[model samples]
Target: MSKVISRDGTIIEYDRTGDGPPIILVMGAFNDRSTGAPLAGQLEPDFTVINYDRRGKGESGDTLPYAIEREIEDLNALIAEVGGSAFVFGYSSGAVLALHAAVKGVPLSGLVLYDPPVEGYDGRLVHQLTELISAGRRGDAVEFFQSQLVGMPEQVVVQLRNAPFRPYLEAIAHTTVYDTKIVCEPPKQEELAGISVPVLVVAAEEMRDKFKQAAELLVSVLPKGQHLCLEGQSHHIVAPVLAPVVKKFLLS
Candidate 1:
């Protein structure tokens, strides 16, 4: 395990492995370095993978009064520790952070984003999620997020409850507000136009229509972006499968 101290003095912990171009893995809500371990394992052979615990989870520190800019600084601090610019891949809310950083002029080798939930596509679901959080039903918030954001079926949600991810899910359940803040507004093409690095926007074939729309928006707006749809997969199943695609795009 490696650690980098951010400008704000938060200790961001990460695992560094493999050999080749550095690929930083930014996990979505409810995931830390451990939860993203499998996807990182798949890409380790071809790329140097940096999987980390974002603020408030795992071995990282969290300061109150969270601002999205701090998360961007966290990524910047990690990239600096790894010797500067590298390929970046973000999933869900993490994708929003990556996109924001890229637009802010972070030097990225390339980028791969999977199923990011941006605003304006649907407002009712976001309102419901906020309601769940306000009610202090963290577990229910997680379930609602999976079903509403990722469009998971009730049966699939039940299956996930028994998976090893249950704890991680619970950890970020209380942080749904943070996710909502990041996704409150749809990403602007003008904001994305500044990203000059190659990009791959991956979407799940089985995800909700909104996810597909979001992916399309990213691809269309990014200056150098390509879109790829993963057949027979949803958000959870697509991460590992997309890891290789990311490796190919970044390493090529």
Candidate 2:
């Protein structure tokens, strides 16, 4: 693991591996660098994969009074650390952050977004998540998020409580609200239309209306962009299946 200091003086920890064009992986809410590991390893042979804990998760340091721009600044710092411009791939809410960084004029050769949960979510949900975290109900927060944001059914969320990663979800429950702040207001189409870098937007064919709308916004608005829908893939994508398509797009 390595560390980079952000413009705001926050410490961001990351793992850098392989040897080629660089790709930084941004995970969704409740996910840290480990969530990015499988995709990172798959791309490492052709890209210098930098998998990092977004601020407030894993080994990354957090600065109070969180704002989305601060998170964008974190990625900006990591980009500079990796050396100027490079490709960036973000999953779910992290994909929203990647778009925010690009639209805000961060340096990037291209972008790959995998099913960013971009939506105009209700404030009540965010408020509830905040209350849960504030009351030290991290497990409930995790279940609430999976059922709401990830669209996992109630039964599945109940079954998920037994999964080994449930603790990891609890461990990062504090960041769930941070993620809500990111996705509650997605970049307007006008903002997306201004991105000059090439973008590859991928979503599953079976994705719900909102997800499809979000993915379409990315492709339809970006000046240079393409869309791909995996036949059987969903938001919870299979890395081996995802890596090849990403490689083709990034290398194109």
Candidate 3:
């Protein structure tokens, strides 16, 4: 793992692999750098993949009073580290984060977003997530995010209580609040339209209506946006299926 210092002096940890144009991997909630490992492996042959632990999760350091701008600054530091401009690929809420960073003028050659869950959310979710995390209800916080944000069924959420990965989910529950703050509100059409960089919004064919709509909405507003739906895929991304499509769009 490599480390970089953000503008706020936070220690950001990331793994760099492969040897071509750089592509930073931004993960969604309940994830760390490890979440992108498979995709990195698949794309390593053609892209310099930087899979990083978002602040407050994995090996990355977090400063108190977290704000979205701090997260943006973290991306900026990584971008500067990788020759000042590169492709950025964001998954789920990470996609939303990438969009926020792009709108703020973080230099990027292009963007690739997969199933961004940016629709049908509101500020109340931010408040709810914050309260849960503040009260040390980490497990509940994790469950709430899975149930509400990820739209996991109630029965499925309960069934996962004994799942082996349950502990990992609770361990980084605090970061869910950060993600909620990043994506609670849907993107403004005017703001997204200003992002001049080419964008590829990848959606899953079997994904729910909200997700498909979210992908379509982004493509509709982005000045240079295009949409692609992966057949037989859902919110769960298969690296082999996705990496090739991503390579095609990014290289085009």
Candidate 4:
């Protein structure tokens, strides 16, 4: 494990592998660097892959009074550590954070996003989460988010809550609100108009309509962008199919 101090003095942890132009994998909620491992392994041969734990999870540090910009800074710090600029690939809400960073001008060579969970997150969800965490019902907080926010059926949530994953979900439950907070207020289309870097927005054909629409809408707003939908794929991209799409885009 390696570490880089962010602008706010928070230590961000990351693991690096492979060789070539740097690429950082930004993770979404309820996940740390581990979530990026599989995809990272696939990309390692063609690119140097750096997968890190986002603040407050895994081995990374967090600061008080978190701001979305702070997370953006965290990503920038990684970019700086990897020789100033590199390509980036974000998954789920991580894709949203990547765009936020790009709009703020993180030195990126190219950008690829895999089915960002763009729609459905709103201010009200943040409010509910804040209230839940404030009340100290962190477990219920996770349940509510999985069921209501992610649109999982209540029955499925109940089953999973009692399973082994519950502890992991609850362990990082507070960060759920943090994820909600960052993506809650999306940037106006005009804000993203200035992002001239090449971007590839991806969607899985079997994924939910909301995310598919989000991917399509996202591509529409970017000045230099393209779209691809993988056949026989779902929310969790099949790395074999996804990696090549990314490799082709960045290499071109």
The alpha-carbon lDDT assigned to residue 3 of candidate 2 equals 97
- Each model's TM-score? 0.85, 0.95, 0.97, 0.96
Q: What is the lDDT of residue 49 in candidate 3?
A: 93
Residue 248 lDDT in candidate 4: 94
| Per-residue lDDT of candidate 4, residues 149-212 (tens digit) | 6778878987887798788888878898888887786666887788999999888887747677
Better by TM-score, candidate 4 or 1: 4
Instruction: Choose the strongest candidate by lDDT.
Output: 3
Please provide, for model 2 over 1-252, each residue's C-alpha lDDT reduced to its tens digit, 9 standing for 90 to 100: 999999889999999998899999999988889889999889999999999999999999999878899998998888998898889998989999999999999998899988887756776788899999999999999988888877788989999999998887898898999999788877888998899988988887678565777677668879998888888876775789889998999997
Q: What's the residue-level lDDT of 85 in candidate 2?
A: 80
Error of 4 at 137 (Å): 0.7
Task: Give the better candidate number (1 or 3) by TM-score.
Answer: 3
User: Which lDDT values do the candidates have, in the order given?
Assistant: 0.80, 0.88, 0.90, 0.86
Compute the lDDT for candidate 1: 0.80
Q: Write model 1 residue lDDT over 124-184, tens digit each, in one string.
A: 6667876886787878998887776656789999999888868777777756656666777
Which of the two candidates, 2 or 4, achieves a greater lDDT against the reference?
A: 2
Regions of candidate 3 where Cα sits further than 4 Å from its true position: none
lDDT of 3 by residue, 1-252 (tens): 899999999999999999999999999988898889999999999999999999999999999889999999999999999999989999998999999999899999999999898784877988998899889999999889989888889999999999999998898898998999888855688999999999999888888576887778778989999998888897877999999988998998
